[model samples]
Target: MGIGARALRQRVRTAESEDWDFSEGRIFGSMCTQPAPAAVAAARRFVTSNLGNPGLAPGTARLEEEVVAVLLDLFHGPAFGAGGWVLSGGTEANITALWMARNASRKREVVLPESAHFSFVKAIDLLGLEPRWVPLDDQGRASLEDARKAIGPRTAAVVAIAGSTELGAVDPIPALAELARAHGVPLHVDAAFGGFVLPWAGPAAASVPFDLAVPGVTSLAVDPHKMGMAPVPAGVLLVRHREMARSIAVASPYLSSPQTTGLLGTRASSAVAATYAALMGLGHRGYASNVRRVLDLTAQLLAGGRALGLRPAVEPTMNIVAFLHRNPVAVQTWMLERGWDVSSVSAPSSLRFVVMPHATRGTVAALLRDLGSALRRFPP
Candidate 1:
């Protein structure tokens, strides 16, 4: 009531100006994406709806169910009725799965690779579970041999990355699944980066078994916000059986249903609607096209980096391409000064680039040109 609309609009414009333009396609820090217009429109349409309390918005609940169904099918899982829920992002989805796994296995030990996302550290800290860190293989995938030795009677679950955040290396999931089956433990695949891209990544992607169809993978976390071009705060945690959600579900007497299985209360219905719209609007073919383009850009990025004398840390399995440099910090600084938003990978002392929908071919070529100039100055 106090501030005029004109002033408020000015404030919003000022704030937006401070942030980097995503459409410029220069950011390479995190999995930042330009939300698809269809998804954004859907979010705007459902902005007032609430998904936190299902009883209050049964229609939104149905839409959420549909989103889950689409994701499940994409991940090659069982039918929609099996189990899953849309959450905020990979972190929440990961914690929810860990909570269920801890309860289901009746154990407090979780084993994952060092390459696992920092979200697992939060899970271990929040849940009071002991974490056993396994080493990564030469390719940056979780070591299958070490995983076999890690699982024991107190082991709650083993986590395998579908497409790791740093180098985008897909793990030996089928082998890890076999280990889980042998140990009678749950295996959760963190497909936050790959889930939207891999299924449509052509026949070559079939070499990596990182889907629910694999024998012993019991659950997974996939982010619609990452590669699905959905608005932010849209992630889905899926499990093999519906009963899995039952174990750690809490009873919310105030809500329509007596039990609530999700990790968060008062979720944004807009995100759910947007994710649903993205799946429906793009479909499989649309996503396949997007992945193909991203992969192509990634190839260009790799080639450009190599031509500039930087070596790739790993063979890119997905849309992420990282190259090790003699002085990554200097390169990052140089790129930033030139209006590029790039990040450094600490593990291999490299520069990371995520080729997503926003990274157009022309923009990638421009980036390569700039990168060449930066290398000439920095010499690394």
Candidate 2:
């Protein structure tokens, strides 16, 4: 309104316009690709079969309850005072968790590692709570000592990341739990990646527990959309204690579904049905194997990186791999020209990769080749 209206309106119209192929984005980000190893036929069948009937009735509600129960068992909340809600995606799940932790504890400050998903910061901002920043170790794992320094009476809760977004670092949950216990604060785990992989990681560790099964983990946010390989907009927040989730449970009888917890609105049972089908589709062994494959790829590529003289940021134990190049901008451009999409990451100056389900040995080999060539040609 302040400037030339005609030019501004035309410029705005142009900016909003583009022929973006929706499926192209999913081509690389096929988190749901594992659900249907052959194709999405099986996953699609599950969605169509359940949602084709239409309308959110009592049957749909049961389906929602079933998915929640399965996730609760998966995340070690079943035995404790476990409860959860089916969510649209990682953001909603995180938002719900932050809100719950704030309201339940009635405190002004929450502690989280610097490497946590950005949503935690966003959630804190939106919810108007102070986040006490915890630094990470050399390996990117959040430091318990740093978190301990940040906590006191005003510390409402401690949020630990099971699988960090940039580097896939798993903070020491048991240590953080001890800190939370000393202060009588609830501990929340954001396992957006590790939730699906923890069960697999635990067995190979040849010993102890994985997640909330650890005594101190009171709640977790598991994104079905990320590791569960469900369709987009699928995530679940599991609280070890149902009373903890009580903060988000609205009691409006006039709306009809008084028992439900989460953002008050029409629930999408379709995503839940897809998630249930995906979990059942893989079973435990298949998922474990898949996790190992990505980990193996991570190792292989990290080795390749070392061979090529690219300094890796952390020794990866999960799908994400990050490293600093001598000249990152040029390296990224050269790599993109050759094909393959890599992302720039903060916290450490580096390129980050999600070794998704599609990345095979051959694929990794090709990527490594490009990486080596880029390093050789890198500007000093």
Candidate 3:
């Protein structure tokens, strides 16, 4: 006899209960938050739809288009000629961007920062492209001088990180864009985390230019799942021109669309629905409020760490905070033992924390109390 739905659900819930709950606010090392209620509902409603064969799910496809359009406007892309797709998250989006660049330029070298995500490593390996790494400055931003030296005739694309994973550093994108323009190569900004945060970050982030609006920037990737209060598997890839994506297209003879542009074949429409619902429900003001709350929480974390004799690695540029530590890995292990899930960064040898929306004042206080005890034990 088949198992009943109630029993199956109970078994699943038992398994899931073992995992850390974001609402408890112990997860400080991740970029993702507990998705918005509306987003969750929309995702559930569209769980069976698939955009891979758009003819069968035309409404879902249209929803995906609308999501792309909204993101393009948010990122300040060109009003008319820009195009995008909702793919499987930053890795696929990054790979797709490089694939397009490699096909368009027929070049093997990609200039990028040391702070760039590990996804780029996979991208270059899979695409048969070479990475010309540029060192970062004291502040974790990419060194523009080294980047200039790295670019050459063999360069396919210049990769910049708008929100670095380790230190939350924003690279000198405007300068890099100009350099790429001088070298006649395309610029791809990995704003997977910042794309949703920076726009609403107010005047502090206004001076930074890390999108398609800047000249020489051909493509950009952003994740709605990170800071947009959307569920997982929702990444947006925007290109300055519609034709730029054509380089990576392959014929899908049996599908509703003659060609597919991304790495995935049968993507879930749940992500599309969830992303659209998140964007539409929150809008600018709602997201701005979310950003404000997280940023404030980040500030609190930094101040608390300082009071505990922990030094910040750098003044935080976003909701991410890191503190200099003699043994970050040991600290991470200690925190894990205590039921708090934090991370460590290698480059600066520090403990890392991302103050997502799920994190609250009470949680920050609880984390600080544990951190002080950990510091007394670790002596750094």
Candidate 4:
């Protein structure tokens, strides 16, 4: 029905030696089509062998509980009786969160920043709720003032981004939370990019404060694929109140044999197992340190960009760096020639780089070297 497995496998099998990487549905650098390590391999084997969801066995369910607990604890949610569930990706997590928020609300409108992920609009469309655009500040973060203006009683939810897609900006969550609380409305944070990464990379690194620590933040969407560095489909949807999630849970006759639907339907157990393995592979200190690596490298890359007359759209809050250029097309062409996978922003013809965990200082240096040479050849 949806993009089926046999077709996808054939497509991927054909791309085993492609020149560019495919991630988050985009192809840019050479990182895509790379093979998995042994942990991922082992997890895949286990998943295929198991007939059902991770609910099929003690080992799978135990690992699931462990992964959920660790994610819940790290994101500042209550460990006692609180719940965390996995999804296909951030899109699924965000859709579910949006649906849950909409179901909990008495209003019909959802307000989000202009730079909110496209999936939010898609989710809004799917949920049949009206979406209002909240303007962004000069710094590219969501405008607290605009959000305040947008929040009338009819406003069902105020969704703030924890690391926006375009500029890598973060909305002021504490400030946004205050506004949401005053109006007695729930705030959904789409930390799909920033969530797992932010607990390790804090306010000094992030443009805004996030996590369950923000009282008015009703729910959060986090992806373990990005900064969590797990295999795909390792997205998480966590709620501040377990009761709120009850609005979305419905009984199904399909679950009669298993006697449970558990939150989402028959999800892939391999993704859960991969994330569980990844969390253990990169524990608390390790995750924090890996995040720090990307931060430092982004800062490093931006420094080089500056010498070539580029400036941050907003100073990077995390591993993402965005800069404006009069002619991003030309610069992009130059970068592509040098084996870089940066994005050109259409909003203002800017350039943005999402520094992956594997992007080392050596990689940064190589990118800078090519950039410097290109800038000299074509002054923009």
Candidate rank order under TM-score: 3, 1, 4, 2
lDDT tens digits by residue: candidate 2, 227-260: 7877666788887878876676666565554544
Q: On residues 1-380, what C-alpha lDDT tens digit does candidate 4 reach at each position?
A: 46889998988888875735543322223211221354376468666533133345557667777887887787778756567676667788888877777787756898888989889878888889888898888778888888888888898888988888777777888998889899888888888888766777866754445877788987888877767777665788887777776777665544333333234566677777877877887688877888788789878888988977878778777777778877777878887776677677777567777777667777787777777787777665
TM-score of every candidate relative to the true structure? 0.97, 0.85, 0.98, 0.87
Candidate 3 regions with alpha-carbon error over 4 angstroms: 1-7
Clashes of 4: 2
Residue pairs with backbone overlap in model 1:
none
lDDT of 3 by residue, 243-359 (tens): 997888899999988998878889989989999999999999889999999999998999999999988888899999989998999989999999999999987999999999999
Q: Ten consecutive residues with minimal summed lDDT in candidate 3?
A: 200-209
Residue 339 in model 1: lDDT = 88
Model 1 CA deviation exceeding 4 Å by range: none
**Shift of residue 159 alpha carbon in model 2, Å:** 0.5
Candidate no. 3 TM-score:
0.98
Query: Candidate 4: where are CA atoms >4 Å away?
Result: 1-14, 19-39, 49-58, 79-81, 206-208, 256-264, 376-378
Give candidate 2's error at residue 7 in angstroms: 29
Residue 34's lDDT in candidate 3: 98
Q: Give the number of the best model, judged by TM-score.
A: 3
